[model samples]
Target: MNRPAALAVLLLLAVSAGCTDTGPERTTLMVIPAGSLLYPLEDIEAAFESQHPDIDVRIEGHGSIQAIRQVTDLRREVDVVAVADASLIPDMMYRPMPEGDGNYTDWYIAFAENEVVIAYTGKSIGADEITQDNWYRILSRPDVRVGFSNPMLDACGYRALMVTALAEEYCEEPGLFEAIIGGSFDPPLQVDRTDGVAEITLPELMRPAGDKVAIRDGSIYLLSLLDAGGIDYAFEYRSVAEDHGLLWIDLPPEINLGFAEHADDYQKVHVTLGFRRFQSIGSERIGLPIVYAMTIPADAPHPDEARMFVDFVLECFQDGWPKSGTATVADKQIFR
Candidate 1:
């Protein structure tokens, strides 16, 4: 151990430490996805961050509409947006930005599909008795508490309304929507039928008349309530129920909004959002097969990083996440 060699080693260590301390900062990619995507995306985020150590991924979940409103209305600068409804990207984000020359987003990729279901627990009232044949009747009982997301915010919320309305035709039981949902609201969520179509309008503010119905901002939030015995049943996505390991009964294909072949049948029911703010964007949400989509906003602060993350997410889906029943990959096409 010579003195000159020791001095050289100390100087080299100091330079190495200086270089490590001044490395480039990681880029933050902000993602706002549908509430239903929170769990899966958390897994995706872990994998993505592991592969790209220089990028930090942050995800926030909201009801599909609220997720878009966070950008389009609230003007939050987000890097990526993924929603349960593919049409919403065009429906809400295709318009011109308030302060920008271009629309919030010009395009998005439809990547996944989901279906609605009635989720319950073993502790749920009449859980042992509820079946596909008479689940609605069980939910309509006076002592049962039914929960759903806000129709004004979540895609699952409006789909719940559609499922019940469509059930009338599927089950040949008239007024089922009123029995399970409409009559439970304070102002009475009513249905207007015309030209072979059933339309339900939701007020700007919806409050349950009593304990019969519980409403949350997002469908995923109802999972906690269902677990805590706060609500006996909840209208949830099949994926959410399966993801959380809850018991859920599959509704008829005609009303589940899962099959693309049943798209025409699903269209018989429509939900109109009556909020004043929605008027500018058009509030009528026509029924369609549930499809999930994602996009990087035009004003995204980290478009390059967002694109890479989107690619990674799509790859994960293609690898077989749909097999879990969360959602089926819509198409095999990759984002370019």
Candidate 2:
């Protein structure tokens, strides 16, 4: 081959190698979210990424508490944080850091609402005859295995405990909470009335007794167990159950923690976490309508991208709660 032709061939090879050496770089937007929000967040991620190709969104799901702790306690770098409970941001993330690292977040927007329900499958124990009235009894049976998230790490866990405690009143069954979860955990659930108000105590570590009650890190983890016949029933968000196409029974609004009208009744019961993590300082979590919230942390590395994504999510939710089966919160609930 001629010298000029050989030089052209070598130059072409170099250009081709350079083109294939690395793909186009993209700005990453990290999202730390509650486990219950996983499926819906995934849908949102796809939609968001398609519209904003230059920005890549990454989602990491954990229990609501653990999700926020990933930012506040662990000081992990996250662009956006979405949680199952709207109140968690203020309870755990709004305070100033102990080491003078500033606050994790000053504000959050409450976007969606959900209700608690019993998720089961065709293969679940007593699937054919499990009614709302018989659910408590069925779950209490030795042959049945119940599953719930860890209250120390997830909001659904405490909410499940609240549901059982409320059921004792709604169903006119005394000691129902004790019957289902009393001796299951390490410290167990404690309830006592003082000053005409009922207070519940949750242990630092929730180690369930044997296989009777399966306690996982997040509520979403129990869905697989239910599908595999490893568990008879799991207490979970109604949206999650519906999203997964699992068979579920809706509880009354009073105990379901889904309605604003019953907010006062729901507030009658409160849960106190045993472990103190971050800025929460053992605050009591009062029951109310289940509202989901999201925020861009103050220390977020990708602040602009995070804000854009958060706004997109809020708009998506406002335009009829999109992908997620949860209901949109009132306009007043949105902070930014």
> TM-score for every candidate vs. truth?
0.86, 0.82
The Cα RMSD of model 1 versus the native structure comes to: 9.8
Model 1 over residues 1-336: C-alpha lDDT tens digits?
A: 122333344344334434333337888899999888887776677666656667789898877777898888888989999988888888888888888678998889877778999999999999999999999889878899999998877778888999989987788877777778888876788888899999998987878888888999876679899999999999998878877888999888888998778889999998988675554467788999898889998999999999988887775565343344433545754342
Error of 1 at 316 (Å): 0.9
Residues 187-228 of candidate 2: C-alpha lDDT, one tens digit per residue: 666677576456788776677777888888776679888877
Score each candidate by Cα lDDT: 0.81, 0.77
RMSD of each: 9.8, 10.8
Best by TM-score: 1
Give the best candidate by lDDT. Answer: 1
